[model samples]
Target: MSARARRWPLVLLLGGTLLLSGCGLFGGDEEEDPPAELLKFKPSLQLRKAWSARVGDGSEHLRLGLSPATDGTLVYAAAHDGRVAAFEAGSGKRRWAAKTRLPLSGGPATDGELVVAGSSNGEVIALRAADGKRRWVGRVSSEVLAAPAIGGGLVLVRGVDGKLTALRQDDGSEAWFVQQSVPRLSVRGTGAPVIAGNVVLAGFDNGKVAAYEMSDGTLLWETLLTPPRGRTEVDRLVDINATIRVVGEDVYVVGYHGSVALLALESGQVLWARELSSYNEFALDFLNIYVSTETSEVVALSRRNGREAWRIATLLNRDVSGPAAWKNSVVVGDFEGYLHWFNAANGELQARMRAGSKRIALAPLVVGELLVAQSEDGKLYAFSERGKR
Candidate 1:
């Protein structure tokens, strides 16, 4: 078989294997053990449900880029069925709902005035935040798998086709497009571009992260976070599927079968790197970085250097979402629809809650003292510490 054909197992292994049916890593014939049952744990912190509302039929099986976006007062969420709803952040009451009539694949990015979403057929739709009225629609080159980001008067989108297209936020006019070479075989996700001042930072399937000038898509600098290795295409896969995280003047990013590196924001220089592989986005606090490894291990590393702080390995092979830091604890969701909280200082389990019957595929959004989570079954829930109430 050709190299590309041989890599199909790896693509499926990384993307849909765990979600659909349990498949052995690298297509092995061994039967895998089922995920471990939730261990009984003592509660150190109490979490109570504040409220929850239905968005629509959630992403279902499409794994669309539907995540809740918030702007202090309101929260926005989209369903795969093209229904977008805005809710009051405090009360969880529906503000308005808009129907784009297109298969929504990405977004709910808001600049407080306009909210943008992407369709499965490459259409970018913008709606007025005040009421769910259609503002404008633009087109990109391919399917959008990441949430659209708005900043610097431009709405930026990263398409599966390796193109980063920026549209004028006011009228949805094309501003500029930046293209990169895509590997033949890659994991099934895209890293959403992040805007820092006048620069747009984006990661590609080729394992490279590049910085571009937001004004005209001019290339500022590019660095290879992971270099493909091994003989077969499957072994050579190194997609940087995780969204880049920018803290202060440094950028933190990881790849599928690659390393996690801290890069200087202005010069794209690698400050430090450690051999680690993860596709899930990470969370950072003042002292440490929390990441969910591909094997479902949640690890904490020192922010000053890439030294290991702590790791929780009992959740391995469970398909957990990225970590999100809330208050004094770090939170993560799993395929079994449960949210697990751990103490930030030590990796000890502190609390757990079930948000839905289906998987909680994305990290819970942290809005002040409230934790907002969207389940795969279309349920949006808000939670807060029991002591706060």
Candidate 2:
């Protein structure tokens, strides 16, 4: 497609399919842009706060990807301003705090003894999990947008410049780095890679998901998620930025502006591919794949075949937070700080909770029956089921 045609289709998708809320208009200006009908949700489950804490400040316009870390007894979380806090999981009492003084954009990964995280400045730092002390710091050539994946005694890091570097877990020495081609027009890079049985699976911005032999960095298989469609300029621009999801031998990935696909781990054969957009991430239950759109709608699809199962119009026009999976439920946070719990099987709203006056950064995580959430304004909160109702 031509650039003019591509811009018009994106404009139509944004203008025709999205709105802030599913409500009736109350004024003449509001009437010009009609509101979508608000879907009524009966209260099926309750949410309670087990504990709360303030981690760090966050950016309002950009998703910072700083999710809380837990080690059964100790919880580790980072502030947008660069402070890593360790708290007792049972009491939520502050245990220790490490000073980074730089933006910690990604979440921390645990290697048992140390927790590793990357800063926007391209430095990968390790901190002692016991007392929040600095372990080692390594530098990549470009920005580190996603969290590091520690698997098979190798620390896998992806740089914004489209390089996947494998580092030795014990030392910060480089094991291997593969330079992959990046999408020409992408604003961000790929998400965290996943460790399959013997492969380190990663998705790239150029619509290819490749699995490499973790030990030797040899390319085992590479699968295209959004293969060229229409054979035009815009078709060549189609990109995939899904965080690789590995379940058994099947790898699940979503395209940012293209499609959601399931690929075979061994053969790199695409099992099923469907249109779905998730700039952030997706939540997967055993059988269902929950994806959120830039239009603020949550669409559920069959994980096996990529069939549409259900859709919930969140009606939120702003970019949506990611979806988190909790047993039979899927919970998503919005930019307005509202937390929504939906039926994972059908996309039905079950409960809603408010984190604070500010916006939540990403999807709320379910840790030991409690939902942990953080706001952009530097407040961390917890939610749980009220009781068996």
For residue 290, model 2's alpha carbon misses the true position, in angstroms, by 0.9
**Position 190, candidate 2: lDDT:** 52
Task: Please give the lDDT score at residue 143 for candidate 1.
Answer: 77
Give residue 147's error in model 2 in angstroms.
0.9
lDDT of 1 by residue, 84-200 (tens): 999998889999998888888887788899989888889999999999899999999887878899999899999987899999998999999999988766776787899988899
Model 1, CA-based lDDT: 0.84
Give RMSD (Å) of candidate 2 vs. truth.
Answer: 6.7
Computed on alpha carbons, the lDDT of every model, listed in order, comes to: 0.84, 0.71
